[model samples]
Target: MATTSGGDLSHFAISSVYGELLSEMSILTAVETGLLEFVCCLADGLAPQAKGHFFGSRNLGASGDTMRATIVLVDDISRQLGVGFSWKNENFAFLEKVAAW
Candidate 1:
């Protein structure tokens, strides 16, 4: 067997998770529609280079459609916890908010 590099293993892990999430999607119109909206919202926040399968941001709007599943999970937890979620650009103000939190 060929030896796998650390980079290769990392990519394999990420792809596995992504596939698992996508495989669980149903054909329900409401669910699919919501997922699509989430995908677009996350994509809007990602940098072009981060929108890849591997070696980039694993957060919303980074990977293709994967962000939808991720956002759904995050939304569930945040809503249950009664906390708000927001995204801001990589600016000092955003950093300050994070630090304050």
Candidate 2:
């Protein structure tokens, strides 16, 4: 682990009940396209370091047809009342794939 006064690495999270979601993908995309490979994760989507991740402002272009990983921390699912469906509160640690393996 590394320690700095104001270190580098992105953090934050978003919770949604359904579907695939990311709060801000542009930054993640930048990290993915940049020099990084993987990211560390937390139980609730909060993170410390992102190998192929970024923590600050960056100018990025378009990203098309890339692999993305969403690291989920919490998934609270409940059945819809009297319905045949369910609801969920989910959070994820997002990772953008910059290269192929």
Runs of candidate 2 exceeding 4 Å displacement:
1-46, 51-59, 62-64, 67-91, 95-101
lDDT per residue as tens, model 1, 1-101? 12567487667655774455544556633345444544444434443322232222233224444444455665566668665544335521322222222
Give the Å shift of residue 78 in candidate 2: 30
State every prediction's TM-score relative to the real structure: 0.26, 0.20
Count steric clashes of candidate 1.
Answer: 2
Query: What overall lDDT goes with each candidate model?
Result: 0.42, 0.28
List candidate 1 stretches off by more than 4 Å: 1-5, 27-86, 90-101
Best by lDDT: 1
